[model samples]
Target chain A: MMRGLAVASTLIVVLIALALFMRSKPILALKPLTTLLFSTAWHPSRGEFGFLAFIAGTLWVTLVASFIAIPVCILASIYLSEYADKRLREWIGPFIDILAGIPSVVYGMWGVLVIVPLVKNIIAPLFGGYSAGYSVLAGGLVLAVMISPVIIHISVEVLRTVPSDLKQASLALGATKWETIKFVVMKRAMPGMIAASVLGLSRAFGETIAVMMVVGNVARIPRTVFDPAYPLPALIANNYGEMLSIPLYDSGLLFAALLLLLVVIYFNVVSKMILSGSKWSLYYNG
Target chain B: MDKKNNIHVRRLEENIFKSLMVFSTGAIVLALALILWTVIRKGLPHLSLGMLTQAPKSGYYLGKDGGILNAILGSLYLTGGAALLAILVSLPVVLYLNVYLKKGSPLAYIARFSFDILWGIPSIVYGAFGFTIMLLFGVKSSLLGGMIAVTFLIFPIMSRSMDEVVRMVPGELMDASYALGATKLETAFKVVVRQALPGISTAVLISFGRGIGDAASLIFTAGFTDSLPTSLLAPAATLPLAIFFQFGTPMPEVQGRAYASALTLTLIILVISVAARLLTRKFTKHVV
Candidate 1:
């Protein structure tokens, strides 16, 4: 039974690879694969299948989201691990977990009802841009909210590992609590914190439905955050339903899935190595 | 020479930073409250008993739905089937990792690493993978396909969580079992499983919550249907998709139903999370 379960668990990976290989057989030509990666125009109807635009859009949104999420996560981690009393910590901890539990689709719904309008009616007009509301900025903001909990949870764990004695040593030298955190805790937890952020980045990279509902799924390279854009996951999702309509269309979408899987694998492996190097295990060390 | 002044400045900075940290922590709570409030406020008015009991009407997307009975039943069926499949597969793998393989074995290490990596793969990717497999098998979207996709999505999570639990079973207990002439298999199934039941159930509940709330993964594999699913091969409706479809429609009544659906989904998740907590507490009392 045990071996059978192990085989079953591993089978999923094998099946995914096999499925991708089978699906891409029709468009295995080198010419199309290169065009699929490098072409700028994404009009599948005219047989134009460049993916650079979506790649750019995905990167841009992820970068913007990281900028927004990292600071809040670090601050919240420091507050939770170092400053909050036991009572306060107990109250706050569950909310953070609950934040993580909220479904992505609900986040998208919130984005549709809240964030998008805030971007459209408030933020956009201030920047002299039209508030179509479903722009890259709107998507990035939603992604930021979605990923902050992940970053906070990991970062809190990393911060908690900083030996309490170190803080006392600083305090014993007449340093204030914040001074100890700033000079001692942050420096010691830096690597693990960086790993936490990377994990969050990888998560944002693959998030689909929430980003889709807000990102204004135009298959063009966005010149500004206010402009509409498309990410790779959204592309696969929006087009998958219609993929069978055109020649090589199904294969094209499958290739995108393959690319996503490969990229995510690379990111996760790198993250694991980084965390291990920092002596941080995702599970409890005991 | 200005050492006294430097100390004073540092103290002031510390005070400012502490306040900032408090504010940021407060924001997390505020955010959660805001999300729940918005969902309830917008979703409450359209939430009716009929909405829960009936299927969507012909013009349901136009805000004239029967209740979301089809989606509710479909989600239940999909989550139930998928959760059952994942537990059966994961329980053995977890036991083997802890009992069959020696600690620090490279094979066990690699298996753990693989599941960790699998845990990070996104739902959309799973959907795409499922769609590809379905195409290869000449199968149409159906309840079975949706369960298969969700099974893949939750398998890694369930295994990893259970692995953590089983790993926590004290080594002394297993040794005592061996001393009593119990075989490794017997000790594993009889001893470790009883000890790890609470954690295992918690893992299953968490996965069920995940499977039920997911929309992207099931969208490709479970084609939507207005009628309730009667067989494994039948296409199914799910609350997440129903909410998505309803909210996207260009009608006020339909959009209102979207919130009601969102509320329903939230309430279900809330109940599951609470139940998981209660089960963990109850089972921990039994852990000897």
Candidate 2:
């Protein structure tokens, strides 16, 4: 009976994948996968379903978020794991948990009020341009803040697993504290850091309401960070309810969801591989 | 002199990097403070007792009077139902992994991997999948549909979290139970379950917090209604959706209400976090 339960639990992932694929079959039968993925035109009224722009938008937002989040989170995690005293670490733990627990909607609402204005009145103007503030940059900035706790939490865990003996040995060899961290600690934590960042990337990729709220849902490829773009998750979220009136529109949205699921799974599998291959696996599996 | 200068330069570099790390950490804390301040400052004025007690009056979206009572209640019902369902599924799978399966078993690994993938899959995909299921069953977007979708979204989270705690139960304890002539099932139920109850409860609360806060998964499945849902089949309102819809309106007053809703949601989450921490502390007195 226990084995039956376990097997059934494992099958859920397969079941979801199958259900999404089956739901998307109508669109796949109507159009080739390449055209669906490569074309930029998206007219639900007339059945022109193209996902290229949305995919590009998702990539751009995730890339921008990663560029901002990775370095900052790594630095913070280093401080937390290597430099922070017991008291400080204890205080910061609940803060990070609170950051993580805050709902995406609340984040979105905050983004709309604070980040949007900052971009519109200050950041964009400083760049010698004007924006409505609902742009890829805005989305990316909010997403960066949103994913920071995830990356930092994981990276700190990974960094803490670097044995103190190694750091002591480096110090005994006359290496500076910085040198010990940069060479001895970071070298050992590289694969785990990659896994942490990849996990963050997966999160930023799949995040919906928060990014959608700020990303001015225009269905076109954005050429600049200040321009607006519609991401794949947003595409499905905003259109799924109304798509029932149009033929194949529902299928198209489901296909977008399928695309998201596949990419997230891919990233997760890659990170899991990196994690299992590293010494951090001991820390994790234990 | 050259060697001394080089040492000075290295010391400067160390200081610079240390300061940079401090600055980055400071920036994250500042961002959190800023978010909280913005929510409180904006939402405070609009957050009244009427907003808590009353449903949206007619033209509420047009800046008329109304509260998010429907959304609060609906969110409670939806998340409560989903958390219950997820616990039902997650407990068995988590127990089967830690108790029934041997350590390092391939099936256990496969199950964990699958759950990790499921956990990574966007809530939007779950929403879409839930909608597909609803279509197949001829069900409308309703409380039941929302619960189903949220169950999928939080099941992995609950399972993985519970697995972590259950896995921490000492092997010797199980061995002791076995030596007492207990069956594997009895050991799992009486020994492991008792030990892991704190963590299991924390897992449930955390999943509940997540499920209540999630909007993307319920957007399609929980079709929004202004009125409180009377049955599982009726469309339900949720706090996140309430904020989203209210913020989308052109009226400033309605948008303000959105901030108020956001504030309410954040407070709910804060309470859950604190409660989970306290509960863990309270319950761990029994564990060895």
Per-residue accuracy of model 1 over B92-202 as CA lDDT, tens digit each:
899998999999987788788888888888898899888877776877899988988999998888888888789989999999999999999999999999999998888
Off by over 4 Å in 1: A28-34, A277-280, A283-286, B3-5
Tens digits of lDDT, candidate 1, A189-234: 9878887888788889999988999999988889988988899998
Q: In model 2, what is the error at residue B219, expressed in angstroms?
A: 0.8
Clashes of 1: 4
Q: Report how far residue B215 has shifted in candidate 1, in Å.
A: 0.8
lDDT of predicted model 2: 0.90
Candidate 2 reaches a DockQ of 0.64
DockQ of each: 0.55, 0.64
Write model 2 residue lDDT over A1-286, tens digit each, in one string: 7788789989988899899999999999989999999999888788899899999999999999999999999999998888889899988867886668889988898898889888889999999987889999999999999999888888988987889999999999988999899999999999899999999999999999999999999999999889998999999899865788888898899999999999998999999998984443321110
User: Fraction of true contacts reproduced, model 2?
Assistant: 0.79
**Which segments of model 2 are wrong by more than 4 Å?**
A277-286, B1-5
Chain B TM (all candidates): 0.96, 0.96
Name the 10 consecutive residues with the lowest summed lDDT in model 1 chain B: B56-65
- Residue-by-residue lDDT tens digits, candidate 2, B114-160: 88888888899999999989999999999999999999999988998
Clashing pairs in 1: B51-B67, B54-B67, B57-B66, B63-B254
